[model samples]
Target: MTEKPAKLLPPNPTIGVFDSGFGGLTVLRDLLPLIPGARYIYLGDTARLPYGSKSRETIARYAVSSAKFLEEQGADLLCIACNTASALALEDIKQAMPIPVVGVIQPGAEAALATSEASPSTPKSVLVLATTATTQSHAYAQSLNALGLAATEKACPLLVPLVEEGWIDHHVTAEVLRIYLNEAFAEAPNAQTLLLGCTHYPLLQPLIERTLAELNHPMTIIDSAAATAADVAAYFPPNPNGAPATSRFYATDSIEKFQRLGSAFLNQPVSEVHLLDLGG
Candidate 1:
């Protein structure tokens, strides 16, 4: 929906969403209801995932390759749903593709600014909790500042692994969140908006709210996945008359794991995941 183009909607358009792993499905999950008429193609670069650890150049290469793949599939628009990719290589991917490529970080910062504006804060400030690579990129800080909202980014290195392990409701996860929030709050005491900067963090949202309540720090929690979905939805309206929206799942490797874990993220069973060989 974002980065408006001269022409939009090609009559039941194809939208491609790419993530390093299952996380992007969460973005797809939100999109399904909003844009029910468009066809969705989601590709998870699972075999080469943990894009966080890669260098900027390497990450750019991988992300561009993935984006080009989706473009080849006839994608009218692309969503870089992975925060790591969004942070480090969004421009690279954008340059390589002719389609509009929306990333999670900018939409998230804009959403946080909206939240801050609606709140009673004298000046807007945001506390972002994301993976190490995302925080390290300082992407959120730069974006929020550009919008006149102060930003504080905390790297929750353990959160991704714990979420991937399906320990979302576990006490350990809650305790870890507690620590991270407390640390972030200390850095940005006036921040009234908390941005979940990573896709994996959305699944832990309920627990995060609980942790915030327990800590007595009541800040508006912003889910970037949802924000990115809304941004994409801004481009088109529902096509109820045309065929129902259908989604195709693709992965570079681990079809079984993608189906099993992806369902949790998408909130629906992922059908036969086609194995794609986008090499190293």
Candidate 2:
């Protein structure tokens, strides 16, 4: 495994990104444009996914292993793109790994704070849309509150399946999101920022904006994938003339499904996903 360099990053650092499944590709998608001349190693632990259902200890073990695997592949930085893993096992992974590990919660909260400050007229409140486990974890609330921004976490349990099923613009999906947003808005009318707590939500950003306009409530939308990418981007200076990024994707299981769905998540073709077996 590569050791953390004394400095933050090299000229063209290798970055590791991991999620339980295909959703993490969204983070990688955002990263390519932000940090040019970089290498990305993405892992979809498809064989043992839905880390939300596992115990905290188990989640930590799995996430740490994934981080180590990426490190072994020459990653200097790691992004735990999964909300459940970020909520449940971030510290464990950070402690075990030799590199910097940035999770979605802090970046989202900080971005909300920055955006809220930019708009003095709006309330310093954030509405987070995430999975039930993430909402119950209250990780976003704690992070936001620490920065003097109030947070309301709404668990959109149906959104993940809807997203995975490629229903980004379907009417039923829109209705479900509309209901969730309305319910969340009812809870926090003052929320000025909508934080996407789930990486899968970036694909639904267009539809989310439409729904907000339909409800006559237009809040600044924050994609954590973008936020996390920006956070990682801070490690290096802008280099417009840098070389194009190269990527390698590995899936623990279902390479075909990962390649199929990963294309949509990445908004680009995904080919030659290597199969990796991390023992259970």
Candidate 3:
């Protein structure tokens, strides 16, 4: 009698992704294709956005609540897609959660390090553009230095609000970006790489690129959200071999607005967004 070969079942677990607002959708945009078979539960806490200015205690509380909600929703793994939250709340969230929680900062730091390798000399000065919280935390700079790279970080607190308002091409946005970029250049003139330390900043990439061009500076701008997605792909377990193909979107407020703004970030229809009361 011949023995039958075992069949492989798809991974039933869903990956939970969180952000303070729509910014994290950019992370999801880059993530989905890489893990096409895995199910994703994306939650955007639009109700309490702009976590950048919030106190550490508040941000940590919100992060823990968000993670608990996701876990209740059957998340096997979690990714904190918000740079501000990742900067301020990652440690507390990790401690509060039973499952693995990844943050955007470390993955982005890894990507920037990889890019810096192109010019190994001078210890590779790098610039990080991020929210006030991220800049204040010095997460990118510390991570880069830990990896033996000289890093400069600047706070672009206004960038995310502008991006969320769908003002990427606005002249004001360009001017604001120029001001922040100038600060970065002044701090580290030899910087050959610019890390878009916040997910929302990628929406302004073209303008940022143009501003850099005008300065006659040709530095690589790393999109941290995209890099985070790459790291998530690498983190997924291979034993499952396959996973569910569906993705679900949830928001703490205005599912309609999320869908509308999400198109710009995800470059796809977010017609399936479901509203969440979150029982505040």
Query: Of the candidates shown, which would achieve the greatest lDDT relative to the real structure?
Result: 2
lDDT string for model 1 (1-280, tens) is 3366565566588999999999888899998877767899999999998898899999999999999999999999999999999999998998899988899999998888787777754448788898889989999999989888888999999998898888999999998888888888888887778899989889999999898889887878899999999998777755667777899989999999999899888888887899999989
Q: Please give, for residues 1-280, the per-residue lDDT of candidate 2 as tens digits.
A: 1122245577588999999998889999999988779999999999998888889999899889899999999998898999999899998998999888888788888888889889988898899999998998999999889899889999999999999999999999999999999999899998879999999999999999999999999989999888888888777666788799999999999999999999999999998899999999
**Alpha carbon lDDT of residue 169, candidate 3?**
94
With candidate 2 superimposed using the best TM-score fit, by how many Å does residue 239's alpha carbon deviate from the native?
Answer: 3.3
Q: lDDT of all predictions, in order shown? A: 0.89, 0.90, 0.82
Alpha carbon RMSD to native, model 2: 2.8
Expressed as tens digits, the lDDT of each residue in 1-280 for candidate 3 is: 0111133223444789999888898898897777757888999998887677678999989889989999998887798998878887888998999877889998888887887776566348788888777888998888888888788888887887788788999999988888888877888898888889988888888898899999898888899888888776665544345553567998988888899998888888888888886654
Candidate 1 regions exceeding 4 Å error are: 120-123
- Of candidate 3, the 10-residue stretch with the lowest lDDT total is 1-10
State candidate 1's TM-score.
0.96
